[model samples]
Target: MKPIRIVCGTRESRQDFSTKTALGRSLLIHEAANPVDLMLFAENKQGLSSIYNRAIDEAKEDPAILVFVHDDVHLCDFSWSERLREAVETFDVIGLAGNTRRLAGQPAWAFVDDRFTWDEKRYLSGIVGHGSSFPCNVSNFGPVPQACKLLDGLFLAADSERLWEANVRFDEQFEFHFYDMDFCRSAELGGLSMGTWPLSVVHESGGAFGTPMWRESYRRYQAKYAEGGEPTPQETSVQKQTPVHQFHNPDLLKLMPTNAKRVVEIGCSSGALAREYKKLNPDVHYIGIEIDPSYAQLAREHCDRVLDMNIETVSAQLLAEDLAADCWVFGDVLEHLYDPWQLLQKIREASAPGSCVVACIPNAQHWSVQARLSVGDFRYEDSGLFDRTHIRWFTLVTMLELFTQAGLTVEAGVPRVFDEPQRERFLPAIHAMAAAAGRDPEMAVQDALPLQYVFRAVVS
Candidate 1:
């Protein structure tokens, strides 16, 4: 077996190596145990591609297996060198984690869309540990040692000869982001085989996702790989359809009364919230009301009862006689309703006195809406604040009025604000406008910040 040469870029210098860095410490420990076939190389004050390319070129003379890894990764498996050796026998290139398939506009290895939504677990492979310390919590994506189209660049290994022969090198144009993606695509185009391998590694950083710098890198990536082909009819139809209902609203779950016995959730999508909340209070009788029969069928596995009918059409007398719910949850459902005010009134009338109402509603006064409106771009999207299905909109003030008019006393409200960099100029402009309108500028800016509001209310 060829010797494994580990190549990584770090901000830390030689003198301050093992004490400050995760990779340095892991190397110090692993090298102590298995120093025979392992070699280490490091570069500081350079972009990742430059360092990796330099290492790849140098490996031509040495003719060793080159492993490119992030400086924040801690290699937990002592037998990793042997694993890499075995992996390269079958695959020319190997990674610790990867996706079996790649989408046209994939922003990341594990993600299928620009929304940063993860690809289905079925198409994913490999286990990864994450934390700031050594004993990390493992996230098992799926069974590994499988062939993959895209691999996570956090830890990648390949025989230097294979890369040199295939003429596959990290695209120097991509400094930090998309380099791995570019390299993987280039290798596949070059007819080099790729697969994921079982290796224990802990990555410290969660990544700078949604940051301005990351977004800029994504723009450059799209520009470089942008193709002229349009989506097929089937693909267009798939894209237009709403995503599967699997996400649980954390804010709604948090607002739920801890001791509530019976809970009725309006627009329960796949019983995700019920499934999650059931872990806390196992004996709670949960009922889900969903218009989609398929979603209701899925919800039946989690909830005590699943009502496959629209809330707007359900009679108040039937709701009061059957449900008698102590807690009612509406997670991002009110805005989609033709008349949420009437629905909430019916809920208040149907539920027990002092019964809790936990709801998550999108705020129309978010700066993104104002920013887009200024440019006459109020275009509806497949999802988000301007979802095409949304029939009504509400700001914080209007939302409060919504509950009050429904005879629900507002107990608490939590604003969900992302404080994105784009809001820097928009917020100040909003404050100025508020002042001109004789409203308190500080309070007005506060109202404009949150993209959504979560409220905990009770029947009065």
Candidate 2:
């Protein structure tokens, strides 16, 4: 297949001209290094829409796919183009691109001017320029969806014929910003389909024009839209969706004793697992405790009983008296606590003797982690074993120690599935390490670093 043709447009700066020029040159060099075709254009302070239109016009005769990206953004994953192409074909949309904070609209102007506080959802509705790709189908002026009305400027693509026919030009009235929103709105009104896929590109928020341009744009929007009465912004509500566990560890679920009549799940987020337990043991009574009121409410709807209280603050005696549970679960909960062992001791005291304690703690010492640390990459973020909110970290040995100290005897211990690409990249090394550690070396790499360490222990 012919490689996609990517085009980028930027302006030369006198003060930072060398820096900006080097940046643009580096992008071209990187693109070539990836063996991808790239054509770049640098102009002096032209409207973004004008630059885009010129690039589109220049590439009109080329039979290859056209991809437009902002100069400020960096391509992290080299396979993004292929993934984006696949998504575009699957979704049948004109373009696919990355997520951005500033979208097209009036509220964004108010936000820029400090006239309004930031609402996480609406911040993007006002300024719409982003990275996007265009497919051949977009060559014909097509109807787009209402949801995409304000996001027109990011990375977008279209066929050569429709690009000229639709006269699909960004409104110069927007000058610096809002052109993307205007364009997307125009596309939607004219019947075109524009969408954003799960694939992403890294965008450095403010690399070009600084705060002055933002202030000016805010003034322009206020002048244009404020007089016409504020655009009735769309209201978006957080929807309650079912928790989909892609990593299935049935052995962890089996740890619950069949004869148990009562069960308690501490930190049951949305009560999904508790509901599963109820299904497994239909006659058993289940009670779940959650710190978040919203999740607790959802849990109540799914299970027989739910308590809206933080485990740390809730009196142990009160919880013990409320539900004399024979089985207690601490699934994926210990990592977030200040003192998991203390909580485990309380749970041990609260539950009946011989009650099963099913705990799922992510193994921090998994081989993949060791490799990442060996490379001097200790930076942590949300999710995974090193999730930012995790106040406590654990390894297989530490976790076993905690459970044993809590007066529990292990019945079963196994690793949970670790399927994330970054973590999976460490699997071969992990398998080798597991073998070196004199553990189950023959185990499949998929089983080497289970997403979590699931322990089924009986209270002794």
Runs with alpha carbons beyond 4 Å of true place in candidate 2: 1-249, 418-448
Give the Cα-based TM-score of candidate 1 against the true structure: 0.50
Best-matching candidate per TM-score? 1
State the lDDT of candidate 1 residue by residue for 275-394, as single tens digits.
Answer: 999999898989887766567668888887776545664556546755678998988888877678987898898787889899999999999898899889999888899887677999
- Ten residues in sequence with the least summed lDDT for candidate 2: 133-142
What is the per-residue lDDT of model 2 for residues 1-460, given as tens digits with 9 covering 90 to 100?
6456665566754344325543344444456445555555655576766666666676566644556566665455456666656645543234432122222233331232234554344323222223332211111112222123234344565443444544455556665565554555444323344555443344444323326775566555545422222331211221222232323346667776776787778767677776667677889878776655467667775566665444553346444664567888877777876677877777788777787788888877766667778789887665676666567878777898998888778888877664567765767777787788888765635444555788888877
Per-candidate total of colliding backbone pairs: 0, 28
How far residue 244's Cα lies from its native spot in candidate 1, in Å, is: 30
The pairs that clash in candidate 1 are none
Model 1 spans > 4 angstroms off: 36-43, 227-460
- Each model's TM-score? 0.50, 0.42
